[model samples]
Target: MDMASVQLLPDDVLADILRRLGPHDLAVSRCVCKPWCAVIDARRMLPADAHLLPLSLAGFFTVSWTESLTAYFSRPCASIVVGKLDYLDTDDARSLSVADQCNGLVLLHRPTLWPDDQRVLNPVTRQWAKLPPYPHLVSPCMKQDSYQREDMYLVFDPSVSPHYEVFLFHSVPYNCYEVDVVDEDAFDPAVKKMEWPPSSYTLRVYSSKTRQWETKPFIREGEAAGTIGDMESALSPGHCHAAYWQRALYVHQHDFVIRMTLSNEKYKVIKLPLGLDVRTDDEPEHYLGKSEKGVYCALLYGNNRLGVRIWFLDEICGKMDWLLKRDINLGNLLANYPWKHGDRSWTTQYVNDEIGRSMTPAGAKFESDYSTNDNVIVPEYTVSLLGFHPYREIIFFRTSFGRAMAYQFNSSEIVDTGYLQGKGPHDCVGGSFAYTPCRMGKLSNNM
Candidate 1:
């Protein structure tokens, strides 16, 4: 009874007909043969398509804080995930960097070390996990802290839990002390009854299902946006971007948004769309994501149209806010592309000298000897968003003229998806994370 050839069924009836297929039809029924791809890879049957599809952006990691480098942008037929993390066995996996990525996990850290070995990568199943040194850096009040800033964040959800969490997020210096101080009014009423974003806070979380490191506590229901000394003012500058959604996490600190929720540990602050002035913004950038309609907040708007606006967090009825949705003006779409070094000002100085001579840092050394005519004056190109599209309405960006774009928003269309090159000229794109690939099978450095 070949109902159109099941090849005489039975591998438990072809896994009950491939469990009613969906994960893009069970990855196109594993190429329809070779015995249904060895019975779908020997019964590991790839099924949790996170509530049925919509997790395919497969590429982009970026990080490059002055060239420690993470870089991995896709498309050139995406030859199966290889961001060259060099198997992260670390003794200096080039001093690591990417401190956060979720769903398909990735936390990596070793930012110039100090108990910062932190691992946890998955780059499409080159599975990894390491993390363990951060129970408050062996507290003695963080070894008598005089200054500290911590940030980690990576909270996975193979559709609700295949177990993964990291979060950290700490800061110190509301009134740091001890320079052999003989009490300067004993720090004046503990810095006037302390309370800048503190109604309660604890957070240290780690848990890959009890592989340890705990601390939770968060309780600040509302009213308190600034003044934890504005988290050491000079307004944020970097390291603050988070998004987990549903199990809650949000966080895009400074000029509002803290959220937290992680199953009732409770936290709230949300406010960043009422004349949106992240301290007179001239772009320090902003982001917090979850897409295909849910939570979003882009905002990088260096006037004169090097645009980006986005926003959408509308909870409605229980009343949450933010509404404007999409403004996009990428300097009039790179002044109409198609340039070839003839116009848009030496094609943006030959795409910033071919992205600083073909992206450096991997062993460095890839120099360039400048050459451009038309009186070279073309220096002004910057747009960096690189996220969103967890389900589409696209939006990933880069460009100080090196290009790594995406932008879809219901097809206002712009694709290019490649080159983010850079190694100097203050090497940019310091953080970007959209990658999405997760079958979540292995990933256990056994705690």
Candidate 2:
């Protein structure tokens, strides 16, 4: 009996199978042939149900280095190591950590005692290109040896275009900007915080196709930080998050949502939904997250309940209507987490309690109420919202000791993800973020 060759299958049938495959499988499928690769690239589409699809999360990363013994200034030593999640397999022994992840390419920023070099790496293809330092680091106007990270975003879609663009939002500062700096307070009349906009943000885009970084016209969507314009009833700026929705970018500023229409290249600032908590007088515990419906606001904790409100964008420009999604009381929810509830020490204690003593079936049950910390061993601990799973209705949280956990909205159950990497004197320095991997070699050269 002869086996069927996938090569002999019609292109349509091939695409049907590839479409249903997860990202990991699709990446491996590229090696079949050039034709098969092209077909996968052109037919890339997100699954209808986000929770149903397999997530390509790569795990969070951070720069690891030693403190130098310089008399005047404390700097990091030369040997740089990137501390990734214990779950990931980033064996690259070269850099400090990844700076950003575009569609499929990761900008791995390697900092020496200084940020000596940066590079764009295709983890999927094992291809890397050394990137030049950002202009602020090398420009004459800026002081030497003092580099700060500028907010950056990668604009690319491997399925649509081979060319990728990197956007760097920065404010190049001189060593002493006191005399030349355009300080925020300089704006008179104190524009209402709600009316305040973000205009001071400048940008530079590096195009892979052009192989050069060029200044681009960046359009700020909201009022440049509120001017002293006389409006007595205006609100002040509050805490917000930058979110992408409906092919647009929205940022929570003060008490308003700043909208940027990518298609029309326009900006519009709108007030946030009433009753949704915004940081005005106190630190806000809510986060503005993107969802299929539109922009959604998830209040970390309010009235002792987890609340979710999703916005419905109106056809009339920047207008939006927010509707209440659901409220879940998370009290004692962690009490039923699926995974084992204790640390190494707790496990030892449980074993001793069971075997050392006359262990009965009822006495053998392991105690779940316990906490791990640097100082005290408390029986109970606190938990706060960190963020959401990219696609699912899973709520991610961090305990007092930095242990990450997830609670499924649909399942009404909790699971312990893992404890974060925390060690040394400054154990809290090392943290993690969610990463979504990109598929390399998926685009045609048509770009």
Candidate 3:
């Protein structure tokens, strides 16, 4: 056939090809033709399924006053903006007690003077509605002292069906942490109120569909008072794995691991490896992540402030194996600091040209220099191994400034996501947030 007579492929075919390319390549492909450019732009429209894709990378950039949650097409280098959720101008009276993200939905609890009084859930679209106060079973004996009781824990199970369940675990006057549940159905629009359950000594489970709080018979083997510290202790529950293979929820309790099936209400406790030496403390906090291989991993900062250790769990033998992946000894990096008090906080900056490096890893290094006007302090940080489009080897971490600094795996250079916008350093936040992939499917189109 003559070259001039050859039939051209449709725009959808070209668009699909472009979508498969890396972010950098996709940008170049968009310039191929007007039809291709239109298709590329349309594909940028995020679908809900994009948020549900397992193994996809997501970022949660939070500031003290505002939190910006963004999910990229893959990782940072791809530059494919999938979807974003913003929480701006929050009230100081109510603090963000808990942020549990699951299946593209985030449940944020804002505790009021009355325990479990005000809470909300924000899905991928940022649509939020007030949740009713959890039904509390106040003990008749402690009813008079309820105002003085302060110790509480907010537990959220995102995988729960019907409606997402939020459980309030608090000390009822003379007692320790007891469970109280809340969901959309519990809200009474007419009276704008929910009935609180009666205080009990045992753990209680509430069913949204049944609209009742049933007492859980299983007594967890632990010191209830010591397990949950002082009233004001920010004892946020650590990561709870809803294992796809086992179809159960695995929660780390102090020294033991608790497994509870989705169908059953009681938890089965199993002891972890004793020699692992995993510190369950405030500093060098421990976080959990699962690999595509179904291996459960834990990330913890080293005891000596040298680096982080990544622990892998062997499900076959129920053993824990760990590797010291990165050494972050900042002694050499901090020697240049002129401060004599050691009160000054130190942060690091990546070499700007290492944006696309394949082996460098994604995170900020420790730097003592703050003399330059461009240098700013980063309070908190988080790193993730993300799979961005075009190049699947990019990892990035966001600062409290609402900006994400990404690096290529091979190179140590840094690429700023806010470079094109010219935003300043005061954009980030001070706390850590969760990132989970949302699948791209028919549900996203309707949104």
Task: Give the Å shift of residue 213 in candidate 2.
Answer: 2.0
The lDDT per prediction is 0.61, 0.43, 0.35
For model 3 the local lDDT of residue 255 reads: 35
- The CA-based lDDT of model 2 is what? 0.43
Best by TM-score: 2
lDDT of 2 at 118: 56
TM-score of 3: 0.47
Predicted structure 1, TM vs. truth: 0.29
Ranking by TM-score: 2, 3, 1
Off by over 4 Å in 2: 1-55, 58-95, 110-118, 137-149, 170-202, 220-225, 228-246, 250-257, 270-281, 286-295, 301-318, 328-331, 335-386, 424-432, 441-447
Instruction: Estimate the Cα RMSD of every predicted model relative to the unseen true structure.
Output: 21.2, 12.2, 13.8
- In angstroms, the error of model 3 at 334 is 11
Winner on lDDT between 1 and 2 is 1
| Candidate 1 lDDT tens digits, 55-122 | 46656676765655666665444334454555556545766667778766778787752445888877
Error of 2 at 156 (Å): 2.4
